[model samples]
Target: MFFSFVLCCLCLSVYADTDAVKSVSVMEGDSVSLESNIPEIHQNYIIKWTFGHPENRIAQINKEAGIFETYNDVLDGRFRDRLKLDHQTGSLTITNTTGTDSGDYQITIIGGKKITYRFSVTVYAPLPVPIIIRDSSHCSSSSLSSSSSSSCSLLCSAVNVGHVTLSWYKGNSLLSSISVSDLSISLSLPLEVEHQDKNTYSCVINNPIRNQTTHLDFSQLCQPCAIRGCDSAEAVIRLVVTVLVGSAAAAAVAVLVYDIRIRKAELETIQTSHRPCTHCS
Candidate 1:
């Protein structure tokens, strides 16, 4: 019983060592070669590859002829026309790749003993073109009264990559930002008005497979305040003053006309009194 227990421990150690497999990373639309140092045997050996999980079989190698056999029902439609395997080299090639093709891959070697290899594949598409836009609006009156607070926002997007992170910088100083699972990133910045703060802003996006960056000049991002309440107040004051002056002028003319009519009546009465004396003569 003691000898049997020692032998069992030894077997377990060997099994654990052989179970260790190296992971491989490959880009989209690239070819990957898989080679193993396992001893070559006369007996027929079967090689199988699966994506994500061992249950999701992608392709299997023929034991006798050493050719790759694929199952149409299990294979994904996007990888239908794109996948190719070399029987002799045991290499797999994936032609154009989409974001959904990125996942874990497993390779199984079945012969006298079963050997397994794990591979991690990541596919990256081109980065999306970036665009920069600027807006200057005040949040409160106190901010404007103290000094002009210039605000701006930056937008960045990519084509076929997922789980992206975006960061913003103004002459090396980081600004506020937002990110999503989609390929787009947006950042909002509120900068104090200063001579040195007139530097350009930059937006950077990154993923496990690829990275991209964009820069925008400060001149393009500096926009004046759109709602100028101070200008509107000046216009209202001018309108009120014009209306008051017109009203005062009309009142003065009416008082002068009343005084003139009273003077004319008094002069007519005195002239009538002098005419009565002439009638009596």
Candidate 2:
């Protein structure tokens, strides 16, 4: 009987805790309110707000005792002056929230009855605009990965983004994606496409609440690579130049041979004409 009673109490505690918890999400530098449905709150009633596992008391109010206190200085002054309390509803608002402020907030009210409210709050940093750039390393590599003269190598990237995803989309179809949760992470996703492709492509960086997109311009980023070999006009020009140079060299050689032979003949005639009587017999 004791074991059964203990089990029943445990189950009831779990159920009540789950039922009272509400989820809240906001961007960094934004404000979020944790609502406590204690209407007509006055000094005669006591409302206290606590946070985190140990549940440090951060705020409280009591009208009759003239006590309205917010202990924002507990956690290294993280809360500081960014906390606001609605005395009428006993709701607590946190302004200029940072990721460090994300956690569970619990409010305990003591008036006619004791009531507790729980909140799970999350603060996410703002997402940066994603950019698309040519992946020049792949484009200039000597291996098969090189951006062949017909293809474009590209990458979509974003820096200083937290709790977001970077994705590549072709038309309406998704190509690839990467996600990061660290406070300031850089992410990149690669894509390859034909230079002449006419389909639409875009890079996107998105968080749960907002997104930014950059469209790909094939014509602007990846112009057509000129073919390596020459065209017919270039080939014809080379052949003509070769023939003219060969003809000019052949003519110069023939003229030099003719001049040498004529000079030899003139020398032979002069020697015969001047034959003296050295062996006149």
Candidate 3:
């Protein structure tokens, strides 16, 4: 009978805990308000707002005294100068929240009936700018034209992003994407694609807070092919020029040789005619 009674009490405590807790999320360096639904405070009421545990009191209001207190010495470093209380509503506001401030909070009201309000807070830092890198370390500008296909691997990465999505886009089309709901972490996604002519791509990192994007131009990546085409055109032009120059030189040499032979023949005939005339006289 005693064991059964203890089990019932434990179950009731768990149920109450689940019912009292409310979830709240805020970004780092931002402010959040933990609401307490105490619309009216009696003259003899006492309101205490605590962080994490009831022992670590942050703020409290004594309706009888008509004054409020902000705890500094007990809180140590947290909520030192950024704590505010709305005396009318018993709401607690925290400014410049940090990751360490994420936890459970409680408000205990001592009035006609003792009532408590619980809050579960989460603080996240904004995601950093994502980076994109080519995965093929062996591929260089000089080797791009030598490869039969311009396809290569790429990686997009981001750090300290919580519950965020990372995606790769080929122009307006979504190619690949990854997401994590776990704690803030560094993550990366890989994609392989052919570096076709003048193709455009972009990488995007986004969450509920903010988004960042980086763009890629395929024309720049496949520049080696254009360079190779230019080199081939230059070789063809040089070959044609060499053939024309050699043909022109050969024709000039043939014309000069023919003229020299004709002159020599004419001179020989004149000499023979003059010698024969002398003999006859």
* Top candidate, metric lDDT: 2
Q: Taking the tens digit of each residue's C-alpha lDDT, what string does model 1 give over 1-281?
A: 56654553443335434455555545556555444333332225677777775458777886577466765566546467666766554555666676667777676766545767766666655556455554323423445444454443334433444465666777678775545665433333333334236576677666555667778765545443334444345556878998999889999999999999999999999898777455454
Clashing pairs in 2: 43-63, 43-64
Ranking by lDDT: 2, 3, 1
**Cα RMSD (Å) per model?**
16.1, 16.8, 19.4
Deviation in Å, model 3, residue 266 alpha carbon: 88
Candidate 3 lDDT over residue span 1-281, tens digit each: 56654553443344344355898988889999987665555566688988876558889999789868888776566778888888777789999999888899988876545667788898877777788776644254455557633665678899877788999998889998999888768889987676654567889987766678988655543334344354446556878999999999999999999999999999999888777455465
What's model 3's TM-score? 0.62
What lDDT score is found at residue 79 in candidate 3? 74
Count clashing residue pairs in model 2. Answer: 2
Q: Which stretches of candidate 2 lie over 4 Å from their true place?
A: 1-20, 42-44, 141-147, 227-281
Tens-digit lDDT string for candidate 2 (160-246): 878898999998899999988786878999999988898999999988878899999876677543432222345568789999999
Selected candidate, larger lDDT, 1 vs 3: 3
RMSD of 1: 16.1
**lDDT: worst 10-residue window of model 1:** 34-43
lDDT of 2 at 56: 85
